[model samples]
Target: MSEKTILVWFRNDLRIHDNEILLEAARKADKILPVYCFDPYYFKIAADGTPKTGALRARFLLESVADLRKNLQALGGELIIRIGNPAEVLPQLAEQYTVNEVYHHREVAYEETAISEEVETALWNLRLNLKHFIGHTLYHKEDLPFPIKDIPDSFAIFKKKVERDSNVRPCIGTPESIITPVITDAGELPTLTQLGLDEPVDDPRTRIKFKGGETEGLLRLEEYFANNNQIAPTKGRNGATVDRSSKLSPWLALGCISMRQVYWAVVKHEQANNVHNTGMLELELLWRDYFRFMFKKHGKQYFAADEQTENTSAEKQTLFEKWKTGNTGIPFIDASMHKLNATGYISNFSRQMVAGYLVRDLEVDWKKGAAYFEEKLIDYSPASNWGNWAFVAGLGHDPRDNKYFNLAKQASELDTNSEFISTWLPVEVAV
Candidate 1:
């Protein structure tokens, strides 16, 4: 009889290093097969009737998967690409290959949970064990100070407690060696056209100058830290930008890169440079972990508006059109919104301000704003996007729920000289 094979199902957690699921599969099975499914449901029309994964995100995902396939091939394994539902597809593949176990990263959002449950049921019927591990976050879910149920409602409290008590474990390295399997064959990756998306032309004026993949992600980490020597501080909310901030979220969100590899890279850089700017980069990673933990705690309630508010349903989707089109009449917000519209990416500061305008000034529901972000951002993570949106809407972790920014005020403050605003916001304002 042949050795039982372990199938690694790739979702948002794309990389191989520090991946608990991948590591476990390597230990228990003689041969490992990695699979990523481009589920049609993800590309389906959203509630607003816009394609959930727009052209820009679809293009990035296609490139990211192509890169992953190359990486897996280099490691003596192959990344199998499939379409259709995971619940149906995984079982069929398992039966064909006689796979004994399946491994994957855990997801907490509503749609993801539904798909995961369906996949689990299918696996159970086939007598295959479905194993899941926490891999997307910097801090492991099991190591958190509080249990999921006990997680605090407020982010600051959670951040403070985690900062005081929790520690980020070092990243796990890749398998010493991987064994190639020849039992099954998979098809080539579908192009954007195959995925029902037109090829997106890259905008020349985009601020984000990176591509998708573990190789490119690591190269960026090396390049960014090599040139600048500043470190970010944890406390004081000083709002200082650091050259040390790893712009790995886009790849990390898509699972094209691993958080452990990022952590390891940061540790090596700190040691080599012998500089601790203020543990700011590490602190940001901790915040990333905190948002995931929050999602684990709140579940779908994170997507709803507070029922106790009298004006809940009265909130109209007024500012969304302007915000989405980047013509909110406010220069900074307009610029950021326009930038995101054209390039499918925006800086973190701009993200918060534009989100603030929609939720606070325009009085739109945060979910609508979040859904729009979901449609546009290349780095869109349910945990981070919704978590941050809820925080800005005064619904998630902020103590002061009334966080609104006067667009003009923000324009003067962040772009006092008006250079940042003028770059995106045109001199001739649309009437």
Candidate 2:
């Protein structure tokens, strides 16, 4: 009898906890091999000629992957690393290990899906199977109230329907131990310099210094829900003001912690504390889910630029440079841009404000802003980042006729003390 060896290809879903592919591989195969490919394509420059991944994000990813390797080693398994195209590397690794099947989490974004298709084609030629698991979203695709095509265009409608009709499944238990065949030469993790990015300098004013991996991700989750650290939003006349509460996004974006894990934690905390303050947190998770599903439904339309948008790209690029470099002369926009450049992150309110300023005020293309966010954000997920940008640009299923933000009005209202502005803006540039 032949051994059923399965190769678990780690992509965004990098953790050992509540991982469907890892667990299924453990059950179905005699020995499972875990692998993460540092696909060089992701490191390449985008159409805008800026890096597809900037230094800060590259650093965070490297940390996350390293943590994953360490966790796997502790579990008595080794993470095989390779710096090449997954489409080519996976097939090569499968043949070398005599793997019968390749298991991975499916992605919904355009380039990701294209890569998956390429890998699928490569695997088929070798007569090996590439099984894709849908585990990234809080609400699983199977559990959705409607099919992907039929999902409500308005997020409010989608959220209301899903909450009424669907249920979030309980998180699967983490494996006690992983059994693996001897891997003599699991490759080395790459450094930031090797990935064509310089080392990131730490900033003292960073709201949160994010570290990657399942261990760190779980610890942050515990700390977030701890009695002393229960996060509550600052209320304004409109509603809860924007803050990057909890700071779990980078981990969540990299799949160090699954959405279901976060969702259930919120549920337990609310139940135990007899408080309902976690609704906004849960809504964030749902918004992430909505974006993923929307990408599945709309394909590249979320990213597409109309003819007029393309023709205006030259003019937009000039203004975009000013906005990108924090030279916009608008105190609020400049401050937020400076923070983003320094720390790969900004508050949701800041993001909306800056994005609205760029698209509506400067009349730059929203796609440019989204592309730069892709390069800079440590927590950048294709669905959420692009979808939110599209929403701000009034291109997505935002039911609002006006997604514009009056930057001056918002700054006056939200930053009444101007402390946030003062902190981020340099003294030389301070208004």
How well does each candidate superpose onto the true structure, as a TM-score? 0.87, 0.92
- Candidate 1, pairs of clashing residues: 14-255, 232-280
Candidate 1 structure quality by residue, lDDT tens digits, 296-401: 8778776455663434442254456667776677776776776776678876667878887887888776777788888788888888888888777777655363
The alpha-carbon deviation from the true structure for residue 270 of candidate 2, after best TM-score superposition, in angstroms, is 1.1
**Mind giving the per-residue lDDT tens digits that candidate 2 earns over 1-431?**
98999999999998999999999998889999999999999999766567899999998888899999999889888899999999999999899999999999999999999999999999999999899999899998998889999998788788889999999999987777787878888999998878888777766566567787888999999988874434865665445264537888899999999999999888888888898887768878988998899899989875454444353566777888889988887877787888898889886768888898898999887888898999999999999999888878778766373322233454445543333444454334324
Best by lDDT: 2
Cα shift from native, residue 412, model 1 (Å): 2.5
Best by TM-score: 2
